[model samples]
Target: MSLSKDKGEQNPLEKALAAYIEALQTKPVLTKAVTSGCISAIGSLVSQLIVPNPANGGKIVWRSVAAYAAFGFVVSGPLIHKFYILLDKMMPPKKEKTALDGIKRVVVDRLVFAPPFLLLFLYVITILEGQGHQAAIARIRESFFPVLKLNLQVWTVFQYVNVNYVPPKYRVLFGNALALIWSVFVASKRRKMALANK
Candidate 1:
């Protein structure tokens, strides 16, 4: 049993996972921020690869990747970690939480949290890209409602599962995993809009 346990610990994948879990427990906010930043950077890279920008002669924009990563690290991850904690406090789980509890959590998340977050995301990205206040306003005017509509369609379901099923500690990680794809979509949309505006 000792030999087998040692071998299991020696497995690199398992070791890495264990370390990540430890980090999550020991430093939840920082760990989530780093994870979100890395994932966001990768998502930006994937978007660039999938839809090469003609403006930069089809070159990858390193700055944009950095901006996305910064947004994830500074804004998304920490906020989400706290938000999940807040949600749990707002709807403290009983031994037998009803479906209504989950529904209310989802409703609050979708209606209260998402709209301002989306707006902030659009506004921040534009500013990070060196665009002016007017440009950020224009981006919001052009993109907010359409993006919010899609966000409702997609995230309502995701939030239900997240709030109801996922553990609070893992909630940000769960959301960040899905947000990888979301980041790609947002990046592509932002790029398209930038080109359109220019």
Candidate 2:
């Protein structure tokens, strides 16, 4: 009966999903930003669910979720996408001689971008939650090293494969997919810290 789609044709859901992925491929920055916000919001929701909260009838901390999602959409996603583009432009990825180039990309990414990004994420979350400047500084001071250590351990190895194997256009997508787990980890830590402080 259907001329456009045969019986064996993709279902509507699959077609919609395929179209969405294709759109993401076309617009890397916006797609990644939207993905970041969604993943971060999911992470925050999970964190609140898992972390113990006896106060406020245990409802989800919608404010934290909103703040993190907003930051991820506005800052982390676009910034990292642009950062990876710049890195690739500066140090073109080599297909054959990947060992050295991969190492260089990893080093530069970890040293230059990771530190500042982590700091900014923590500070932004703290500030958005209306924490004072002094409290924000204290939160950064308390959390920075631990988060950085985890970041180094995780991203160093991950970026090696990413830089060497992944194509430039898909790099941000790859990174953001992996960042979903990292989002949960960071959100959990933030929840713990907030509870401790309270």
Candidate 3:
């Protein structure tokens, strides 16, 4: 009788446990994570493409598309997601998430965020350049302030657009577009710099 009664009663938590199990099986959390990842990568490549154009002399077009794509997928995508996720968690939007909240985001992002990403980006470019002869640092060192000013302008402007208008949901796509522009400039500059050096 007790055994039958126990079966009839069951447990409320059993339903919850079952629901949780079902949720895991479907893995919506994982899907969301992946979506975030894709967004980040795509966005970054686009942004990277644009900001490097100051180096371009004449040849600036769609030639750097592949590089921008790869950059987006590999470097920019993963890093952007990490930044966005961390920032979201550390300082999640309480209400509607005002733009003024950018102050906190900027503090965590630029100080803790921008430098590392920028360093890694520079490092990657440096390595790629070194592999051939386009070493980014060497080229930049060949002309310091000009490169500095050019980079400052592009990054600052691009970032402002990204932070102000773009919702975090779309930052990745935004970044990709910006990267594409940077790539054009970068490719053009690289070509010109190479030719001039010769």
Per TM-score, the best of the predicted structures is 1
Off by over 4 Å in 1: 1-8, 183-198
Q: Once model 3 is optimally superposed onto the true structure by TM-score, how far is the C-alpha of residue 189 displaced, in angstroms? A: 9.6
Q: What TM-score fits each model? A: 0.88, 0.82, 0.49
The local distance difference test score of each candidate is 0.86, 0.81, 0.55
Candidate 3 per-residue C-alpha lDDT over 141-167 given as tens digits, one digit per residue, 9 for 90 to 100: 555456445655667656655655566
Tens digits of lDDT, candidate 1, 1-198: 222366455677767777788899999999999998888889888888867888788899888889889999999999988888898898876668888987898998999999999999999988887887999999999999998999999889998999888888788889888888886777678777877998
| Model 2 alpha-carbon drift over 4 Å, by segment | 1-8, 55-57, 183-198
**How much does candidate 3 score in TM-score?**
0.49
What's model 2's lDDT at 36? Answer: 82
- What is the lDDT, from 0 to 100, of the residue 81 in candidate 2? 84
lDDT, candidate 3, residue 73? Answer: 55
By summed lDDT, the worst window of 10 consecutive residues in model 1 runs over 1-10
